[model samples]
Target chain A: GIQVEQSPPDLILQEGANSTLRCNFSDSVNNLQWFHQNPWGQLINLFYIPSGTKQNGRLSATTVATERYSLLYISSSQTTDSGVYFCAVEPRDSSYKLIFGSGTRLLVRP
Target chain B: GAGVSQSPSNKVTEKGKDVELRCDPISGHTALYWYRQSLGQGLEFLIYFQGNSAPDKSGLPSDRFSAERTGGSVSTLTIQRTQQEDSAVYLCASSPLAGGIQYFGAGTRLSVL
Candidate 1:
């Protein structure tokens, strides 16, 4: 089993603010993804970056696999982004199971 | 036709009772997974099913928890003699054979009293 740690357990920001969330893994991974759990309890897929960088809309993510760490950036944050952001990774040895981090809870106030 | 769908959006069961949660994965997807999200907690891996073959049940928390996938399309997670600690959101996800970008269901919120 691998350990995934997320930093800045809680975050609060203005509607137009920006922030970065980090996830560090204990070992190499073959699959890495960022998910946003909405207030309605739907886990939305944000990124599927096992390595390198990717961006969608006002959100972006970078995974430095060699360093066993990943970062998620939210620019021009909106109230809809308020929820729990989780990082999950599957070790190279595992086939389909993903180990998840405790997640960073974000709140954007309008 | 669409994203992963789960049945019985919410379930409330008495302690020591048994309950079943169902998950219908995306069409043509070969990988299905079950996870549990406790209150204010992260998602915990429960089980994984790929195509046919035996499933990886290593993540199941206890003997009381079990899951089965039929025809590689639908899955059912059963909790026997459930306890108060069994209260949580059970989420199901599916990925294509390439195993990239998993799509999740709305999840079944289970409450054991």
Candidate 2:
């Protein structure tokens, strides 16, 4: 089984601040996705960057497949951003399954 | 629906009872998946369906857990003889293909007593 570890298990930031979250996996992956679980428990797909960089609004993610790690950046965060951010990966086995990291719990205070 | 839709946002059942949770994936999506998230924990993969057939069910926790897809659209996860450990948020997600971006629905919160 592949292992996925996320750094800064818990994070608290003042509104308008910036933060970075990292995810490291133990094996090569074919797919990597970042998700935001909001207060309502809604899992919102933030990015599907198996590799490379992408940005949406105040959120951006970059994945270095060769390095077996990915980074997510949130700039000028808002109160609504208070939630858990997850990073999941699908290994090369092609089993159509995702193994998720423990997640970085983020709390943005206004 | 515009996105993945799951029914019975919350369910409370006694132990030894059976419960069924429903999920309707986004139209035209070929891959559907079920996951469980225990309190203060990350998501755990349970099963996946490509069309009406499930190719991999290795993630199911026990024989009491089962799931089925119909018409390649709706999926139902049934848990028979539920236990307290089964109390968790069950989430459903859909992807356009086998290994594509997956969008999730608001999960169903299950509580067994």
By TM-score, the best candidate is: 2
Highest lDDT model number: 2
Model 1: per-residue Cα lDDT over A1-110, one tens digit each: 79999999999999999999999999989989999999898999999999999999999999999999999999999999999999999888887688999999999999
The reply for model 2, stretches above 4 Å from the true place, is none
In CAPRI terms, model 2 is classed as high
What's model 2's overall lDDT?
0.94
Worst 10 residues of 2 chain A by lDDT: A91-100
Clashing pairs in 2: none
Q: Which stretches of candidate 1 lie above 4 Å from their native place? A: none
TM of chain B vs. native, candidate 2? 0.95
The superposed Cα distance between candidate 2 and the true structure at residue B47, in angstroms, equals 0.3
TM-score of each: 0.97, 0.97
